[model samples]
Target: MTTISAGATDPISPGVRHVKRPTPLRESVYEALTEMIIDGTLERGRHLVEVELAGMLGVSRQPVREALQRLNNEGWVDLRPGFGAMVHVPAEDEVDQLLAARAALESESARLAARHATKDDVARLKELCKVGTAYHEAGDIDGAVRTNGELHSLITQMSGNRFLVDFAAQVDRRVRWYYTPVAPVRGAASWREHNRLVKAIEVGDEDKAAQTMREHTEHTRKAYHDLQAGSTAEPATDPDPAPRTRRRRTT
Candidate 1:
């Protein structure tokens, strides 16, 4: 004897589609403000005035206030009792932890992508790589950073693990935030590394893909630290005795 659940195996849905719902004003405002922060439009430690933001975004002050409160809870903004709201400057430990988590997740994504990526997926990655390379070569740091995020996201999608994708999504925006400033420093070399990663996935070499991704992420991490060090270091009046040549990047 066997039991069958109702609607079980209800002929596989005909097409891939998702229902759409209208977003709440507060949520939309939150997302918009978050983007402004992530892309450096808002800048670290920038004061967030409700009325000004509302006017800029063509929204009411209430939603802006709500969004700021939410951002404060999420550590994206600092809301002082009487001083008002300002973007929270990320501490060194915060950036390191987030980037470390990203490295682990993306390295695994590269491994899984090598195992699961279809021919079409590889082709698409190649196309994106070409576009990213063009952006890098043109000295368009914003375009390159945007494409870099896309390429990594595509690799995670190719992993075919929904859980991994969800986890990656959590850190993706912050990663973009940290990456934006270093994009110019990474230059064309970053795209060249991406090409290597794509080739590994295309060949279905899981170990190689994982290793490549790990090294690639490490380079970015190091570059970020280097940039931060340079920013904080006192200006030198004397020429450096050891001026190391920087490796050029593509995207």
Candidate 2:
């Protein structure tokens, strides 16, 4: 027997209707705040006051507080007694490990997609690649990054492996977090690799597809390290400058 409580939803016309499932307000708030943090809208080190977040998200303070506590437990936010909450700046090791996990999962997805991809799947990937390439050329880094995530996610979908899909979903947001720093630096070369990957999947080359995806992910990982290095260390040069050529002619 199906029971609909009067409080379940707003009044509807006196006819049969399907009631959509309602998400818990706290969980919805958590997702919204986490997404803001992952996408850099909240930004690393940005203060998260409960009332401010509540007003911005159009939610009550209690839900926002609960969401912040959840983010804190997940290491996405730091809650302080007096200072409210702040977005946690990811450590180098944290981002590296996240990327490594992403690479492992996505490579499997690529391999499975290679064996399972239909012509339609390949065409969809190509269309997304075109859109991403256009965004990159137009200097819309955010748009390009979003399209890039979509292409990778579509590959996971084509894998037809439910477990892999679930695992990918777990890491998806954190991958975006690490990717944000290197998105502009990666630009066209990244999309070119995606094109190559799609071609491999289209041809049912599992080994090649997996290897390409692995290498493509490694590039992003390296780009992130390079970004960190640039910020913290001086650029390296030849340890020994070539012996100053004796200027015999000048003498």
Candidate 3:
């Protein structure tokens, strides 16, 4: 069995520590802080002072301290002695690991969904795809990301495998944080892939659905690499130097 530590103690003058209970104050503070971190209201590398955070959330220092510790464990916050805490920014290798894990779990879920999904399950997944695509097209990247997650959650539910679903959910939370900070290079492609997966499931092609889902996740990793490369490369201003021209003569 795995045991996780809760770093909670009595609040000390608006410093980061831990709290002991699930009081209303703690719950409220946790929710408020979580929303800020997830929504980019709290930016990466920005220091989180316990006192300021407590003031912002309108809670006592104890609850804020506890919430910070929880967020720290969840990969949303980075705690240090002098700095208190700051938003956790995932490294490139971390992103790769998350995408790899997501691909594994989701591919299996897609296979099971293809075999066992009911008509209602198909309908719900179709609805999620529609909403996700609409959000992507509307340039609401955050909403698209959320709806995309919902689509995956629905697939996991349809798979009837509780263990896989739980693991996928945990991986997804960290993946979202990583993906959101990067530009939305593959949002359209992602939704289209979702559509294809839905179609495969609707047709009850377990093999094709699983294969497509795996490829879709692999594509995300590729897109991330492309985005990173583009950020570092010099801007291109004109067409390729070796542009092809029509042949003028025939022998």
Candidate 4:
């Protein structure tokens, strides 16, 4: 029996060995880091160190730095002069403004979709709803958020208006950052509302679709407010133990 070379692992080829190609560092880093920020894994106010992130992602510092800069430009991170980059935390008012804008854009999108959506568009909406419901049931809140966004995106595209589609896409990204963190707690009710919205679109009911879209966004805003209030009302815990008074040892 002939002995195989050390690098030859594949049975089909005598000399050819499987080679693992290195994934492009910047592309991988961008997606991995962005997903963490979007899903709240990175968390607000958390500082990002390029070295640490690069090491974690199995990449070099250059890619991490580039990714951070891109994130900063997108409002996902803030780079300070003295301190390193920190996750951008939206203020309450900022969140409110985002939701208000989403309400207006999406309401119009729903109306246009109701008027122009073909049978295929309605079927696609139903499929998206089913996928979103499955993800919600599985406790995969992030998955639900992504699929739900797709449903809305499809409707906006089917509206046959390019300008409205572009505006809605930009606003939707901000809406997603808020929704993903809060969805698991409100998944059930949200999915039910999505089903109702889908039905309205399917029947070509413009008024009903627009109204439902507005109400849906309003419900999300209410949930966000309640969550914020509950968090603020919770008692804060001291990180350190209380200091005890020292007794005199040399009396």
Top candidate, metric TM-score: 1
- Candidate 1, lDDT over the whole model: 0.85
Clashing pairs in 1: 187-249, 187-250, 188-249, 188-250, 189-249, 189-250
Which tens-of-lDDT digit does each residue in 109-149 have in candidate 1? 99999999999999999999999888877767678889999
Ten-residue stretch with the least lDDT total in model 3: 242-251
* Model 4 TM-score (2 dp): 0.78
RMSD of each: 8.2, 9.4, 12.6, 14.0
Best model per lDDT: 1
As for candidate 4, its clashing pairs are: none
- Alpha-carbon error at 168 in model 2, in Å? 0.5
lDDT of each: 0.85, 0.84, 0.76, 0.80
lDDT of 1 at 218: 79
| Candidate 2 residue pairs in clash (backbone atoms < 3 Å) | none
Q: Which one wins by TM-score: 2 or 3? A: 2
Candidate 4 lDDT, tens digit per residue, 91-196? 8899999999989988888999999988889899999988987887776767888998898899889878899998987887778888875676456666677778
What RMSD does model 2 have? 9.4
What is the C-alpha lDDT profile of model 3 across 69-91, one tens digit per residue? 99888888899986579988767
**Candidate 4 lDDT for residue 107:** 88
Assess every candidate by TM-score: 0.83, 0.82, 0.77, 0.78
Lowest lDDT sum, 10 consecutive residues, model 2, at 242-251
